[model samples]
Target: MSRISIIGTGNMARALGSRAVAGGNAVEVIGRDASKAEALARTIGGATAGTIGAAPAGDIVILAVPYAHAVPLVRQFGDALSGKVIVDITNPFNHDLTGLVTPEGGSAAQEIAKSAPAGAHVVKAFNTVFGHVLAACTPEDPRPLDVFIAGDDAGAKAHVSSFVESLTLRPLDVGDLTSARWLEGTSVLLMRAMSGKAVRSSSFSIGLTVRD
Candidate 1:
């Protein structure tokens, strides 16, 4: 298992950190609020907590913050993130949930990738799954949630896939980083669906199931 460092102490961070610890991976939670990060780490168990800009000790660092804070956060990390696989798990959505917030011709992952330092591989993943589902489901769940991954680096994608599988989630490689645009779009649709009467409950999640 890989060491997972998540740059946020919010809901997504706690959910992912729980899975990482359950998978026997060393988890680190870093946030702007040191106390909040420490509290999250303690709640997740078997994880460490620290403030942002401290050198990430894990090979895989997850940007679990909001879309607005992601680029600048990566920029702030700068060279400290070099040689690390950075996972961007953000949905670039408008406030009303009617559409996406990404700039024209740009997705959140692509924008974050632009700000990433050299030697860092930016992978887009976990944007499609809601934090509620991530918090509820585990390796013991009958149906594992699907985590769609997109990245330019094959090795980095594989590394992320291995981690996802370790947590008993299915990893779907949807091709290069350009595919992230569609994944972000999917997130918007899923959000709208969840808010509408379609999903009915917050426990629902999206996944790909193939049958011969």
Candidate 2:
């Protein structure tokens, strides 16, 4: 089991925390609200809670915060994150969260790579799925969920891919860090679809099947 630290206390943070703990990993929920973090930790069983700065150094660190909050938090984590696999799960949505805010030249994940500590291996993942789906979906379902992952570091991407598989999700290798813009942009379309009632079920996943 891997040691995982999630920086956030919102629905996504709690959902991922629960899944990590269920997978028998050491999970920590980090947030500004001590009480909420602690509550989520307790609810997730096997997990712990603490302030973002106090979160234990783990093999994998997931930034589960909003797009606007990601950069500042990453700057604060700074060198402390060196040598760890950092998962960028945030989608760079605008204030209304109805459209993309990241630049077309690059993505939030790419920007994070530029700002992260030199040794930190940044990977973009867990951004396409909704928090409710993450919390309720099961691996045994006929159509397991799929997670898209992208990163410049092959080893780091492999590690996160294994974790996603362990959670019973299909892992789609979408190529290097540059692909993050597409994945983040896809998330915007997903949210819009959800709002339109086009994707009313939490079990619905974005995937493709090929036939020869």
Candidate 3:
């Protein structure tokens, strides 16, 4: 169990915060709207809330904000984030979320990594799944959700994998930070598939098989 600071109070943020608390971790929810953050924190239990600028230090920081908001906030956190694991849960989708705002060579996670303090590891994750699914996750299903993770630091990736497992989800190692481009692209495909056009409520699952 690790201390987690979540920067955002939207559905995704609440979902992650609730999960963290349920997993017996100290959780903090930070947002631009202090009242909203406080409300979400209360609902999650065993959590505190505050403005992003005043967020407490934690072992891991989850950037649960939108893609457009991540870069600046990473810069703002600056050296404060050094020596910690950063979980990027944002999708670089625009207003309609039909596509990405980043260029071919750029990704939201990469941008945050570039601006992060030295020693801070940025790992991409939790972008492909919907908030509702995350909120309802249970071991009875025991079926792992495909959660893609990419980071330059192996230790950081491992830490994130443990966190994912704590939530009963699978960690799909997609390679180094550069692979974030494709991971984000995968999210776009997921969105399209889950959309009513093709299949409603369509989602991805991860499985492991052993051949004796």
Candidate 4:
């Protein structure tokens, strides 16, 4: 089972933490507010709670915070995250949501990697799906949700792919870390599509089908 430490107390954090626990993987909920983290840990069940900035217990770290906070937080963790696989689940959308905050070709995952230690592996993932749908303990959809992954390290990407599979999700590796920018664009595009339809996570999801 994958040992995952999710950093945040927000919806994404709660969603992923609950899934990890339900999937029988070890989970740790770390938040800036220790009490909230503890509460979420209890709510998710089978998870340990921790204060932010502490040494993370899991080999895999999920940065579930907002895109704005992602870089600074990773810098704060610094070498503490050495040798760990970091899953960047952020979308660098601007305030108006008209465009991204990151440079044209650069993505949040690539920028995060700049601050990470040499040994740390940063993989971009889970930006294309809605948190509420992913939060469900048992998915009702006949087709499993698609999880697009991109990273420079083959081992790291494989590690994340395995974790996604463990949670009953499908992992599709588009390419190396550079493809994260495209994934971020896809996320924004879908968000815009959902804006007009008023569609919820259950009704709207990204799926992959292969033809025989």
Query: On lDDT, who's better, 2 or 3?
Result: 2
Residue pairs in steric clash, candidate 3? none
lDDT of 1 at 24: 90
Worst 10 residues of 4 by lDDT: 196-205
Best by the TM-score measure: 1
In order, what is each prediction's RMSD in angstroms? 1.0, 1.7, 2.2, 1.6
Q: Give the residue spans of candidate 2 off by over 4 A.
A: 95-98, 200-203
The full ranking of all candidates by lDDT, starting with the best, is 1, 4, 2, 3
Indicate whether candidate 2 or candidate 4 has the larger lDDT. 4
Local accuracy of candidate 4 as per-residue lDDT tens digits, 85-198: 999999998766798899878999999999998799999999998888687536555788899999999999999999998888889999999999999998888778777665
Per-residue lDDT of 69 in model 1: 96
Tens-digit per-residue lDDT, 18-42, candidate 3:
8878777789888888899899899
Clashing pairs in 4: none
Name the runs in model 1 displaced over 4 angstroms. none
After TM-score superposition, the amount by which residue 59's alpha carbon in candidate 3 deviates from its true location, in angstroms, is 1.1
Ranked by lDDT, the better of candidates 1 and 4 is 1
Estimate, for each residue in 1-212, the C-alpha lDDT of model 2 and write its tens digit: 68899888899988888888777778888887889889888988888886766535578999999878888888888888888899999988775656678776789998888878888999999899888888888766887778999999999999998888777788899999999998998987887776677865545558756689
lDDT of 3 at 181: 87
Please provide TM-scores, in order, for all candidate models, with all chains considered together. Answer: 0.97, 0.93, 0.90, 0.95
